[model samples]
Target: MTADQSVTEPVAATGAATMVDVAIVGGGLAGSLAAAVLARAGHRVTLIDKRAVYPDEFRVEKIGGPQLEMFRKLGFIRGLESVACPYDRVLNIREGKLVDVSVGQAYGLPYADLVAMARGQIPDASSLIVDEVTAISCSDDVQQLELASGRRLKARLVVLATGMAGALGYKLGIKRRVLAAGHSVSFGFTIARRDGAPFDFNALTCYGERTADGVDYLSLFPVQAGMRANLFMFRDPADPVMRDLRRDTEATLLRLLPGLRPYLGDFHVTDRVQNWVMDLSVVEGHLQDGVVLIGDAFQTNCPAAGTGVARLLVDVERLCTEYAPRWLMTEGMGKAKISEFYSDRDKIAADQQSLKMAHFRQALTSRNDIGWDVRRRLHFLRRSLTHRVDQMRPGWLAQVRSALRA
Candidate 1:
């Protein structure tokens, strides 16, 4: 059915359940995007979220690399560009010295704005139901959802894109398997120069000086408000340093990342220091009938690895563009059909790569063993040397690297 023909129109008079092809629980990035894609594809889609307007929440505030490609493929590139602050270069440094320069396209913005843009993609207003999902019942033929508003929805398939909020899934007997508890801590805040002058660099990334410090890196990029700073570390959340970072943010930051002082040049935190302690996890007992999980609803990623957006995009693209349409075309939304998406090669790879990168970043940041020490040094050296070579002969290094890949 067309998006203009909302299931709500039919069910309001009868006070019966709205029958939809897909009932997406959560209007976050994954759910909103899925609803848009499915609705535009002429499927009857109902997107339910507790919030009509996504609040300003700290999340993956910057996106680049393969994520841009996915947005382009999903026809949201222009929309993303409209709401984001774009930059094409990044200054990479280590211990107050330039390690290399990363030249690529990236966008930075508040996570709420990103979700808002995604929600705006939906064709019809009625597709979004600003209500909470209190209970869910699933089976092979159809799935039922009971909203806190007393409205009910029945769908051929349910896409649980509720993100890291796992309570709803827990009710369905789905449990998260915590691979690493208290895995990483991330801090997000806005920063600006004291003199109110624009910073010299387009974007900047400063690596940790000492392994024991447990700092992974500090990434500074442009957003609509000002420069956004994301600090990722593999450290104890209860440490006094965490308190200092929140209380005495500017001083504590410079103390931890000394090299940053020179680049920042007397900056201050322009907003509250928002911090999060993330656990590395993936869901267990989720291979059930009638429903499938996507995005953080499926697995969590370390912020330092910068793989969260990539993994979620893989889930949305694979499930919406491929499996969901196919599943809806067939007989029933059974466990057999749901398993197809879980077993998808690209989805599996993205999920696995997110976990792999998470471990890699933790080890590279905190491990002081001789093996890791040597590897870490070599890693920076290889990047520094490659940058120098590329600077000496701009196109030469790229050509050699391309040939090696071939």
Candidate 2:
């Protein structure tokens, strides 16, 4: 995958040939959304990913909130409307005590639905090659890409949306090699019986505890009407308690779901359990010269935070909206302008993830910490202040309207 040592062949333009405005790597959620945005904006986009369609993915499900609005904007949210199971309320159980509960009957949409919608938005791409990006080279004027099937491409911009590809990015000198294998982990497991669970599917369930070592957080909610619910447990790898969670899942659930025993009574382990590690670090930097990183490649946040997909989608949407199309439409949109646009977005996407991570960590680890007490007190104060402000009833969306207008 060396820049100059590429095994590429000239790809004849299937029809009238034109250079691709943007070349995106790895057609996962991140790459797919970026391609859709650019293509719909009338930019010639070539997207390459190695995977077979709808490959077996580990991220089983997720909760939806303000992010649904983002899905709507991307035009990928429609298909999910039917398959997405609705469970809006969140319950927080801490160290054998029910501490906080948000019962809003909110909805939960699966990752499958989200991806389906994003893919649906752009029905076709200039060259949606089902190949991997074997090589990438970029400079002030043009971006070069080498495909696994030996195709060479030139574009105004090349985006390295490949997930956690350190070797690839480092070889291109796009980023200094850094070990980001973090200790924060989220493991998903399933139980056999769920129909009679003492709890209703209308509310989501979460349990958290902060030990002397670190944090442990669990999320439980129904995925579909007849199908069983899923249990997502997140723990810091550095914490000793997490080492044995897989062996002690039943006991852990027993402790957390005592009230739901009536519903869980008939369930026995009938499915093979599966889990994957989560990284908690953000990309050190977002861009350099010819290449840019998006999605998990940029900021691999804690999954419990569930902001990875949302932030990634927003990044592509904003970039395609404010930058990509205009670049292709004009004759002189060059490296200087592209560089500035990418630099600004890189900082913003990374910072937004940092802020969200802070709130998530504070909430999920406060059970046995003095800092948690501070977090709760401050959160309550903020809520109180917000309530008072709402009483004033400013009908004006102007504060934001003016910024958007500007």
Candidate 3:
């Protein structure tokens, strides 16, 4: 029987637990997608979460680049497109002047909607157990989970896809090592013109003008309701500017990014300013028997760097597609089997690249050192020059790049 079709219900009074091939401990994008993948593979899978519908949260709202390829490989690109508002062009600007136009496919949507789309992919309605996972006991043979409803689950393997919630993992002796505390802050809000006119551009990106501002960049993209704005920064969360930005968003934005004034004519923040402070971290002591940590449960990524989704996609793809199924066919779930996922070349590369990009974005935005000053200048200059070249001779740059690869 398929995983979704053969859900074993919890037995009554005597407290007998349901047995499955895999139990996913979070219904976020990672857990839900992993559940869908494993269930489709014919493995008995149970996805446990506290809520039936994901709440409106400020997380990865836009995804593009290699993420599309990964989604296509996993056969979810079409589903993703259905829920997302697609855009193909981005007007990039720096200090009120044009930088370069980025031409590629990207998508924007509410994180809740994205999570719901992933959860809907599970064919078995009963496979998703809407309950809190109170505690977990793991071993080489089988893993047992105690739910808040007094029901229990016994699975051959436990996939810890819990994003940033460490209580359950803590009970299992899995601890997060904070690599950088208060690494960055992100603000999300919708914007619209006072006259109710459409924006001049489909999507826009405004880079920070001054280093002291600690502002990295402001990204404006289309969502279902209105134009969504994401302001990323490296400033202290306790700063008075933060309060001003939240209370007087438009005024503070214009003051900080005066160049944006001409581009955005008579606009106002149309919704509550949702903000998040991120701490870059990774799980320690996670390598154990019967349980595996994936996504933000294993490492936290900077929103400005935009690597959280990439890292999680790599984890799900590698674990669900490669390691998990192969391990299940063997005798037991142990450290040796679990280590294969953590050590997978692709997984390790994604994790390392995420950390690297986090540091790079923070430095490029706020570092005013002589060395960084030159690097930052050349970074923009290089892009500007390339744009000019491509504009003058269309398709020339692409041909040169292709030849270089050859």
Q: Which of the numbered candidates is closest to the native, going by highest lDDT?
A: 3
Against the true structure, whose TM-score is highest? 3
Ranking by TM-score: 3, 1, 2
Query: What lDDT score belongs to each candidate, Candidate 1 first?
Result: 0.91, 0.59, 0.92
Compared with the true structure, the alpha-carbon lDDT of candidate 1 equals: 0.91
Looking at candidate 1, the ten consecutive residues that score lowest on lDDT are 1-10
> Model 1, 1-406: lDDT tens per residue?
0112223232342368889999999888889989998998899999988777888888979989879999999989999999999999999999999999998899999999999998898899888887778889999999989876667889999999988889899999999999999999999999999999999999999999999899999999999999999999999999999999999999999999999988999899999899999999999999999999999999999999999999888898999899999988879989999999999999999999999999999999999999999999999999999999999989898898799999
* lDDT winner between candidates 2 and 3: 3
Q: Against the true structure, what is each candidate's TM-score?
A: 0.96, 0.75, 0.97
Worst 10 residues of 3 by lDDT: 1-10
Residue pairs clashing, model 2? 76-117, 88-106, 196-263, 197-263
In model 1, how many backbone clashes occur?
Answer: 0
Candidate 2 Cα errors over 4 Å, as ranges: 1-18, 95-113, 176-181, 192-199, 210-216, 225-244, 255-270, 284-286, 332-335, 343-350, 353-406
Error of 1 at 70 (Å): 0.7
Supply candidate 1's per-residue lDDT for 30. Answer: 87
